[model samples]
Target: MNKLPPDPAPATRLDRSQRSGPTIRDVARAAGVSIGTVSKALNNAGTLKQETRERVAEAARALGFRPNDLAQALHRGQSFTVGLISNDSFGRFTMPILEGLESVLHDERIAVFMCNATDDPEREREHLEQLMGKRVDGLVFTARRADRRPSVGVNLGDLPTVFVFSQSDDPRSFCLLPDDEGGAYLGARHLVATGGRRIAHVTGPERFEAVRLRRDGYRRALAEAGLDWRDDFFLPGEWSEQWGRQAVDILFSSTAAAPDSILAGNDQIARGILDALRDRGLNVPGQVGVVGFDNWGVMVEAARPRLTSIDMNLSTLGQEAGRRILRMIGGEHFSGVERLPCTLMVRESCGAQAKTLFQEARST
Candidate 1:
């Protein structure tokens, strides 16, 4: 067989024309003022007289010259661009969110410079420095952990930052997390309403805020139904299909017996569970009901049983993050945190009798 060549490298969105627009010196010449006076006026320095500031401003406007963001950063030590950093897996989850944010930021004409950290602190540090050099206005990071405090390169105090799809213990930075409590509550409610009791939970690593929140949501649901929460009924593992398989072992080994329904932390985990169950001659929704978080349409549709899951609304998540950053840039203030909603998607995995079977189950 003949071998195929590798794909071409992706083109960079950044270009010289985008970065190297009109210059401050050009503005100063057009304004007919000393470069220092123009700089002072643009920086809003009190050293310049009020009339002088007006003249400089008028000159800049006439010449169609805007302040060079790079030059302005060198003087005032702040960039207008915001630094966005995330890992590959997080990048996948954040794509829709970015789309949402872009919809808003594109209107504001503010640029978002992104970096892939690959979960490496060293790489993160390197990217952080690069963004600082670019004089980014603020930052938005999606990873749960940072190798070093952002202050190592950029001034976090003067610059605004917001975290999305992750949590930070820092009180100063704003955070937005998925509504795990709500998702869990809804998952349990769905199962119960559909005649599911003896529920099982396949969860992600406890270290992740999203994972923990989903687990709590499941627990709350179980409690609301007046059912005892069983630790043995829980399958704890990584966020992968393999972990879902591992969860199955833990589920069957439990003394209380395997559950009729399951709340998987995410779709990938749920997929593993579905496949493993089939290997054991189990019919999903008939022998076992399954629900997953992060409703990846392609994956869910392609699955044999077509897994039922929750939509974390990542696009909405991104949109909100974009809005927050724009608000900060535009001098609007937002406080505390915002939590987005999750939607429950029904499919065969939940074992809800087919809508056609609904009448049959009810008649029975």
Candidate 2:
């Protein structure tokens, strides 16, 4: 009697065909409606009875069904995706720009596809083609250097495009760049104000547009302050720490009056100058002041006395580019280059507050 009644097979067991997760058809079946009706109800597209819409929604919730974004985008004729092409493989400049762009576009539910071209024209062309094939709504082009660059071989057609830290060969294309000249002036003026009369400029190669622009700014600042420009005061070389060190050596060797202040091209070069100064036992901001560009946190903070540098506001440039691209996509057009202003980040290197510290120390 105990073993007499074996349990019957469970009636709730799904068949092989029904083992998969729910689909629109399953939702429709569960809601006692057609697939088309279920789609319209779920998407809230076509008009439907209130009761039917509620029923479809409930069925979808019970089934844990989510609409396919790809399909929805295709139906709407917009991918809602943007491509970011960068030649800055190291991400020294591009990363901040990308962060700003992403921050702005994320609020609008837009996605970004980033591609590093590594300064290779062919690879850039390939990425552009692939993004085009993916039906990206727009593109943002950026580079490590903010110079006018040649076409990447893609026509770009009607796709909205924005250039950041770079420019297109076509004059009609829109671009965003930092005010390098302004940044240089700020650094030079700061040094001069802090009692650095005999100022020197140590920078990258003369071929770079940045070098020329910054030099011009430095000269303008000196002229405005009534400081005479000397041929031996400018040292143009590589964008390296070693170059900075060497430039300092050559500067002191070639001149009877040494520079009381040095304006470096970037943080790295500034660090190099600091090293040379330390080796010579010259006190930073006491005997000489230093100013660097880019305000790269890593290099600036690592220096013994810290660095005072120009902040290019790269993220701001990126945000502006993002806004402009969205506008372009929205049928509003803009052309020509736009330059964002740079801000001075005061720190120990330039000695803006050193005089007060010295006076306080003496009093104490």
Model 2 C-alpha lDDT per residue in residues 1-364, reported as the tens digit of each score: 4676878877897876677567889899999999999988976789899999999999999999877666766767778899999999899999999999998999889999999998888999999999988888899999999989997787888799999999988988988988888888888988888898999999999898889988988988899899999888998899999998998888778539999999998888999999999988899988999999998989988887989888888999888988988898899988898788887888899888632321100000
Deviation (Å) of 46 in candidate 1 = 19
Deviation from native of the Cα of residue 163 in model 2, angstroms: 0.4
**What is the Å distance of residue 143 in model 2 from its true position?**
1.1
Leading candidate by TM-score = 2
Q: Assess candidate 1 and give its lDDT.
A: 0.74
Report the error of model 2 at residue 323, Å: 1.1
Error of 2 at 303 (Å): 0.9
TM-score of 2: 0.88
User: What are the Cα lDDT values of the candidates?
Assistant: 0.74, 0.87
Off by over 4 Å in 2: 1-22, 42-44, 49-64, 354-364
For model 1 the local lDDT of residue 273 reads 90
Best lDDT among the predictions, by candidate number: 2
